[model samples]
Target chain A: MNKEVLKALERDARTTPEQIATQTGISMEEVEKTIEKAERDRVIVKYKTIVNWERLGEEQVQALIEVKIQPQRNVGFDAIAERIYRFPEVRSVYLVSGTYDLAVFVVGKTMQEAAAFVWQKLATLESVQGTVTHFLLKRYKEDGEILEGGGEKGRRQPLTL
Target chain B: MSPRPGLNSKRARSLISKRVEGISPSGIRKFFDILSTMEGAISLGVGEPDFVTPWHVSEAGIYSIEKGYTMYTSNKGLLELRQELTRYLYTRYGVEYDPETELLVTVGVSEGLDLAMRSIINPKDEVLSPDPTYVSYGPCTVLAEGVFIPIPTTVENDFKVKAADIEKRITPRTKAILLGYPNNPTGAVMERNELAEVAEVARRHDLLVVSDEIYDRLVYGVKHTCFASLPEMKERTVLLGGFSKAYAMTGWRVGYAAARHEIIEAMTKVHQYTMLCAPIVAQMAATEALRAGDAVVKEMVADYDRRRRVMLKGLNDIGLACFEPKGAFYCFPSVKVTGLSSEEFAEQLLVEEKVAVVPGSAFGECGEGYVRCCYATALSDIEEALRRMGRFVERHS
Candidate 1:
């Protein structure tokens, strides 16, 4: 068995080599050897927290801000959208074929704060001609799961003749 | 220069409206959409109660139609319904309001919530609400050009928002606090003392309290407290209640809001422009529900309690950690043992065992490793769901 692989899986990546070896029932030498190789091969990525932003007292606002941009003669609309999305407030950016050229998901503390951020920060940026922001009215579910509808129980056995 | 029709295009042109793009559809409907396409799929993905509308309630709607009550009522809705709502609030929660001056009946709690946000929120108002709450609050805040500040409540605290936690999130721009008792995902109910503390904070901060008590009647053991009933809170609170959960009339889409006359007046103006009025038939049925649907409500609550006990026991026995829900027909259990994320656990269960449940993260970012299984379904289904869950856990382990 790859001791480093087992060690990495046991503890979070940020853990020290000695701790991983102790936890994963592997030798420290093997742990170092495997982790180095794993990192080089791109098997282990960066560590992250399943952050509870709400607990942090941060007002998390998600809205889809649509934008219409006129690209310069040499540069394209993609180039313009790229520049707009470079701002920290923009969480996600996508270019689509529709009424709007680009859709941006933005987060802010308040509606006015978000509006100011967009108007002063995004709208004034070069290439942006017009923008329409649609606030998400209600989210029944998100991230590929249902938020409601789990109280009742029904059984379904596969048809076995 | 525009390209000619039928010419080769360098980029794909979008036919969809700019308004529609980037606006995610309701997550609750996604399961039903997929369920509809799949043949022989047993779904428990709906949010409403499964029972049919009580007989007397349906008859009231029929009687109203027979009496030719078809013409549109006032923009704020039927005066009589508002009067009854006022009475109901007073009788149930000791909250007082002038029906004509303070109450406005909407399509459902959903519309009331939407109208409240639309009328009050300008561009980026910050709305404080508890995490793992009813799904609509966050999205509605976004749609109304407001920020959703979710206050995470843990199972250890029984999912009740701590007053201290609320104080931490408050900023200069924070305008309102959205409260949902007998909360959706966790079924955690707040007692009167807890609510009083929140009200005290709101009073001190001059923040509006949007209290959603849709599941008020379904609460077990804990007495539901109306935030507006507290002194000083009466002026700043906007109360949302409905007949959907209590009377098993989900499809009817009927609910109402109780607030100060000024706020109600503003909501009525928005309601007039957006939706002329709630469906007359549904309103009629809702009126009947308020008049005489206590027995039905009790019966449904009884069934839910039974299932809650069974499901709670099963979950604890199967090595899953679960806290007994105080209200609403849902059970949130921790699936940390299976070594899978909530979504992965749910997907694997559905695919391998034909059981459907929502991942907790679907409610908010903090809901990872937990899954919300609604207990609104029949007892047989709950038993089987538990059985399948046990088998799945064993296999995974």
Candidate 2:
């Protein structure tokens, strides 16, 4: 499964093939081949940096927009799901097993921009019964990273205890 | 100013046990003293996870407190907790242990190590362990009045203590072999077949084996075979494990020791007198850790695996010859390329670049030309440390 090369790239896409070989104890040629194949197959979709936008004063406005849609004549949620996900503002779309039909994460630069996209584009779509938008007020965590708690810092610098 | 109260007090020194006095102080202490005084020094020396106990486990502790379950637990710790450990050990290693008499919840694997040493080691009995093991093993053995014998290992053989070497060192007085795999400074692990060889030696010699598997779950590219799971070895092996490394529960002070009933009984007697019990609240949290913390542990290990890749590649790329460490969060890179002793390299690197790494000599004499750099830090910090180390190495060269 070339787990070593895939894991290395998943951690940091910037890691060179030589580094992956050294890290995984694999030959450089093997690492290069696995990575090339993975890239060609689209198994490695993207390499991204986790940005703390708040520190840069570019706090993004994010909202979870839950949608309830009527089943179509034949295609059901997939037809409307494809249409909603096609929008540039939609970050993620999920057919949740819950009170809602589809849950989508929408991001914009400002609250007004997010509301405009919802009111202008989403509400007017065919078979989109209604949408409940919840604006994110804070982020204590993101993408499995804790954004808060600098950690109650009174620990003495340990001498290998 | 007048001299401090115990600055030169001979009597005060004598008041400490002779065994404790006999043990040498840590060689890394002087460097750490300077590192502590220096401001803005980034340390890659601490051998611990950067993550705190997962929120769900912490919440369970708080919930137990809210329910007022604040009372002294049994000396062997909570039955519920021990039973959970039983199930866990069984599932992970296929080893069955009786919950009531064969398991003792301890105050971290540190306590379990001490208890195992004290319970079995009579005065002047010898215990064989690898050199450059966790710092506490030798001291713990000495504290129990047993002689600590270091079986030296080099970067060769992937730093695994050879079974032949261990057999050669055994004498009539040798009572036990102490091992920690997925090891600390070197991050060495033994393959199952290799461990079975050691188990064969122990069986032949009729020696007790205290195996510390605290870093059992931290392995990459290898499976950690529980020593007690070996054929007919359950009765002879004291399996020590804990939540500190795997569950990021260092502050909770919860761990376990499982063996035959005789050993657990002896250990519980010492544990009862000394520790009373592992904190009850922490026990509740540990119960929750066993029940729901598997996914969290997997996530944390995934994070460590990525860090391992970066740290190993970065050190080797910087011209420090480091073998790929398959377990734990440390990268032990040889600093011989700079022609500087590990101690000198650690000190100068800290002073010049404001980055701190542990001199490997602090682990053992055989660890002299290497440094232990932990990767359980922010990736940015690790990268920055590597850059500074590269500059330091360049200047030295």
Candidate 3:
């Protein structure tokens, strides 16, 4: 696979295959073939956008829950992680190191809904021993992107020496 | 009633010094003045990178302020920054310099250029430079009371100034040869063998060589040859480099000059007297750039390469014949198809299409008939600008 084409897509998924070919010095057919193969093999899992819901006044409440869980026979934490991740409210699940065996990112329309998911659903899991929920207060950055104050206005003048 | 008599226009004009008076304003100044008032204009005019200085580098500078390191550095520069810069040069170019003696950091490559001119030039001493060069080279020499001789370079030669062409302009009073490559205006990079020949010419003429390598790190595919790295040339060459183009640190105003101790001492004398030092904050930032900014520069170079391809292909497809610019983020496309002079084409394009580009003649006489389109803007802007230019070209051609 052409790693350059993949990198270009990773940076901006909207970049056309034609642009990728030109940018990476690959032939158009070759770029298309590589991208097709990558998608089929699930190398490119998703083409996603990072939207600022706060700007739209539709900000969703989110919280991180550190869960202490008992290991199942021969499965370690994988079975528990899979069960937690399968929940609709869970945004992400990690088999973490340290005091907690699992870290779950739970999102809901409201803080009460998120807390309900943590208490009624997550804390009552068969293997879950205890949990600590840290509700996200405000996001300055998310997914490697700054959330605010980055305007598209040009900084330098139109002419220079 | 006549006690408050005022000088007339001619008398007032005559009151200015001959040196400053001889230097006319930049040819494109009036054009840019018009551009400043026009809203919704997309510019491919300025040579600066569109990217902000990498956050980590800026944070390092800001961190210094938090730690209360805001005082001016030494007249030469911060010792650590100088050492870091010299080490970078040595490791990358295999050219060694004594940081304490041979390096003097100035405000920017702008100041580095000015310092080199003032240090080496005497009255009537001619400095030969490639035509269609950076805007400051000739004016700086002239300000130093030196004659600025232009060696006319053309598209036929791919804008690389030849040693023989440079030799033709030499005379008894010629004291230096000035070169800026991976050049601005033309985006021409002189190959190593070609520069070895120029080094030979300098040796034969026993002339000082001032090489402006501000865009050195921005070259594509091909490697950049440091002028001082040439055999027996370092002693006589004034090497000027900066973090502006490569590191996107133009507003920081920090650059450096490297040479033999004697020449550097002379430059430092002038620098200390006129401007005491480069801002300490800038030096700290430059030090961070040298230490950890390579990956950032590499990523930027790749991005510029992509934009360069899009621009070169788009311009050629639209009938504006353009040479492949292998360095810097610019495409110097000949606007000859439009049947208008470069200035006329630029003015009409801005007014008619709201697309701004610098007219080639603003660089030098040989730069006529072409316009420099910087590809450092966003990909979307470049594509849009090309569309507007295509329409403009179709109508004019």
Predictions: Cα RMSD each: 29.9, 4.2, 1.5
Question: What is the Å distance of residue B121 in model 3 from its true position?
Answer: 1.2
TM-score evaluated only on chain B, model 2: 0.97
Query: How are the candidates ranked when ordered by DockQ, highest leading?
Result: 3, 2, 1
User: Residue A91 of model 1: what lDDT?
Assistant: 82
The runs of at least 3 residues in candidate 2 whose Cα sits more than 4 Å from the true structure, single-residue gaps closed, are A1-161, B1-11
lDDT of 3 by residue, B1-397 (tens): 5686689899899999998998988887877888889988999998899999998899999999999999988899999998998899999999999999999999998999999999999999999999999999988999999999999998888899999999999999999999999999888999999999999999999999999999998888999999999999898999999999999999999999999999999999999999999999999999999999489999899999999999999999899999988898889999999999999999999999999999999899998999999999999999999999999999999
* Error in Å for residue B48 of model 1: 1.3
Model 3 ranges off by over 4 Å: A150-154, B1-10
- Candidate 1 docks with a DockQ of 0.01
Q: Which docking class does model 3 fall in?
A: medium
**What TM-score would candidate 3 get against the native?**
0.97
Q: Distance from true position, residue A63, model 2, in Å?
A: 5.7
Q: Estimate the lDDT of model 2.
A: 0.90
lDDT of each: 0.79, 0.90, 0.92
Best by TM-score: 3
Write model 1 residue lDDT over B91-153, tens digit each, in one string.
977889998889998988999999999878877899999987877898888888898899988
State the lDDT of candidate 2 residue by residue for B1-397, as single tens digits. 9976755688778789876778998777787788778887888988788887888998999999999999999999999999999999999999999999999999999999999999999999999999888899999999999999999998988789889999999999999999999888998888999999999999999999999999999999789899999999999999999999999888889999999999999999999999999999999999999988478898888778867887888888889999978888899999999999998999899999998889998888888999999988887788899999999989988
CAPRI-wise, candidate 1 is: incorrect
